[model samples]
Target: MSDPAGRLNIQLRRTPHGFACDIGSTRPVAASGLFCGRSPAETASLLPLLYSICAKAQASACVGALERACGMDSDPEARRLRQVQVAAETVREHLWRILLDWPVLSGEEPDRQAMIGAQSLVKRIFGAADPNGVLLSPGCEKPTSFRSVLEEAASTLADLMAERVLGLAPDAWMERVETIDAFDDWCRSVETPAARLLVGLRDSGDGRLGHTEASPLPDLDDGTLAAELRGTDAATFVARPCWGGAPRETTPLTRHADSALVSALVADQGRGILARLGAQILETVSLLRAIRTGELDGDSTAPSDAVLPAGVGLGRAEAARGLLVHLAEVDRGRVVEYRILAPTEWNFHPDGVLASALATLPDAEETILRRRVQLLVMAIDPCVAFDLVIP
Candidate 1:
């Protein structure tokens, strides 16, 4: 299992005009080196144990990379199963952030019942897809008999979204989310947990706080990624992920850039706190819908042959937070190298999303500034515990 105790230490210095923020993240990057010399199957089996936050995504990416290294195609059924697993994991993570973390900004306790319901539903969905309880492995076949269970889970998620999160039926919320005005009206009037939290942020001026120019989406091809891996140490790769020679944001907002709701929020609010939170909620609904309709499968193909070397492979997956990448090199059927590029590395880089957002805040009291920092960081939802120090 992943080291649950990994953490991010955030230091905020009060500059003459504004606060300057720096982050020290202690996520596990060196662990990837342990895969060296392991067989492809051995590496695949160890991935879930190494990454607990998005175990399914990690497993999928690892297996896909290893399969390509071995010149094998992924079984379609296995690919679909991994997609469902990733979707389930994404819904659970999004709900946890929205229901458990967002309320802190409003000085309200989380709705425990709602949290429990969401967790239980996700467990059911994941269990149905992987009844044997094995973390996904390369070529791991799944029976097609879980459709009914998935449907039932979808119905339950729809009810929870309507009753607790949005205070409107899924369809109704979808219709209303198309425009900023409609969304603002809902935020002001709806009593759902999500809406109330957002309204609180607006009232406290935090909705507009922490605004920064949104980073461009990453466009890394396998060849570029392989070259980078060959050129850098694992720690450097994990701590300072950059695309096109610059830091970029790789959260839900960037992951679902095409969503109408997300576009509306970005247009109205920029890529501030409100827009980021809205993107997470919209993505939750989208993933749930895909799960319901059995359309969650992503591209299972390896990168183009020109990019794929005989002994090196790369795999990419859209995790709950953002893109996840795994690269592996094998020689004589033994692993020679492995690297994982997690989303947090990109989003939390010193010059990346969270730091840029923090640097934009106007002057405020220390306590107030700290609270705002807390909310903004939660909105980004790093995978590790963080300490905020203002000195």
Candidate 2:
């Protein structure tokens, strides 16, 4: 003696927050007249459509969720290790520029196509660096001077990844797997770009300040944000402990959709001939890092629930460049009721453009501006394939 129709009374509307989904309604609100209709394929498309750049991740989230829903076992944790391995390779492969290749490419960054050359660089040198895997630190009955060994290892293989970029076989560097036994004999090790860089340096005693070996953490040595991260979470990798007690008072973003706002911030005319491809490189690596490490959780776009909405929904997924978030709502569920915020929105937010007046601010040194800006953009982690840089 129950109304079967009540079970079908599900509502999806374009509220001010995000895609407003009202299912399991206790009160009869005439769902037939106000139902938010979407095809099954449309619903499926929503997941990947929002995160195509990190197709691996998009697929991971979808397949993982679907498998769980269907009671199918993917053993996500088992695959976690291998996924991280692939992630490392993909992150390097996704970079738009090779900063190191800068010196070789006539003091300029290499174009995006050479991105594979970059990740291959990291993989060739660190393929065996995974905690449960092998590395080529040969002939060590008892080993010491980890730095010296790291430097020798990095440089030797860097030369090889570089050659592969030019379409050469890396048989020379590819043969290091033979020494995995000797290297594993040493104490447990961790991986990071800076640590890897130190491993690459050739006999530079008392490694550079940015060299990761000197730090408490291995991952904090390279890129734009390394300096600021010297004593902070942003500086540390996910593998490290996050200090400062639960990120203080994170304000969940709101969905404020004015097509004009989104349209205004977007670059028209291509913003052509920009030299800083490092921004794009960081974005790519960050996404790859997300899979190897963990989900870079932040506020996500919500499917606005009328009753006690979760203030901070995490729209966090690592995109090709980095994390992209759209923290807002769909109150009634439509363009007018929704907000669309992109990563570029914050980085390019017009905070008073006295920026154009400075030919160079008298003491204008590049104060990790590029890194900070790139970090901010990467934090959003948009999946849209279009380039986001303006300068």
Candidate 3:
């Protein structure tokens, strides 16, 4: 890693609007760590664009890391929180989905209020009331009440649905475009903005809560799981004779370790897991910071695999929205190739990731067919659209 962002983490909050929520983490936010040379503050400023909805995803990823580290599944309240987290994410997604579809549904008016209301609810649900409850947290003391937040969010959802049915936009308002797609496609495609929180909250097999026989997931060792995500082939090692020199290219997590040289490598050069584990430990911290700062939520999962390969590599990070991948290749300690396989790309690939590998190459045009494109995109719960119009 060249220069890693010194330190970083996502945190979480529960705003007191009864049960409001947000779930996101590291999208365009704090392009910290190793992706860019940008400063944390600089990266911090860009977070809003990547996910203005619920940053619960990022927070969730961190929490997942915590759970994985400590080996705790979840308690009743935690489980409920996870479910609600997903629900809130669904609401957030639908919030935009309904709004986005309005234009095509009809030359309708846009319900910007409802849209904005969803935004606020994201804070309420995903945010924690002031700490002291004395005033800082939600219920403790407020110029506002939780009811208003929920009321507003509900009203917005109602208004948005009404607009869809009537094919009219809500406002003394502005006009917005509607995305017309088949009913089924729309149903699955539209969902909470930040969903990793829900994934973590639910039984996504982190080995903590509910790995029961009835539970739908299998037990996955976090270490093995993280490695699996990188693909079995990703462990190819390169010996750096320079020892202390910067890795031609490294992960933010790696750089974080190196900068804290004491923590990165051993004086004897055999620190291996110790150093990696140390970096992993730091990743959890950065995740917490992201959560507290509203950079993420319970909906997102930490990216464990990067495909930045020797010949070429792919780095896959499960961001608040979905998996964001990076691919690279280093030739004799020099950079040979670098590419990104964003979550969307993997999701939108013709065959799924595993399948694509099986098929040898991809059929981009065939994959571009409307339904196919939609399915592929939805696979990763993609936030972007697949405008597969026949040209």
TM-score leader? 1
Ranking by lDDT: 1, 3, 2
Q: For residues 1-391, could you state the per-residue lDDT of candidate 3 as single tens digits?
A: 4212121111112233221112222223223123233322222233333434333433323233323222233332342243234335545654453344322222345556666766575556433321222221111112222434433544454354434322322321111211112211322333421122212222322112111111111222334434433443332211110112211212222234344432323232222222222233233233322322334332323323432223332222334333333333334333332223233323222322212211222223533333222322222234443222322
lDDT per residue for candidate 1 within 228-347, as digits (tens), equals 776746558666877767888888888867788778877777788888888888888888888888876655434555566678888878888788888889899899989888888888
For model 1 the TM-score comes to: 0.94
Cα lDDT for residue 102, candidate 1: 77
Return the lDDT, model 1, position 312. Answer: 83
- Output the TM-score of candidate 3: 0.35
In candidate 1, the residue pairs with backbone N, CA or C atoms under 3 Å apart (3 or more residues apart, or in different chains) clash, namely none
Off by over 4 Å in 3: 1-54, 70-79, 105-110, 128-224, 230-346, 353-381, 385-391
Candidate 3 whole-model C-alpha lDDT, 0 to 1: 0.30
lDDT of 2 by residue, 257-332 (tens): 1222211211211111110122232233333335323443321211122222222111222333322322122222
Candidates in descending TM-score order = 1, 3, 2
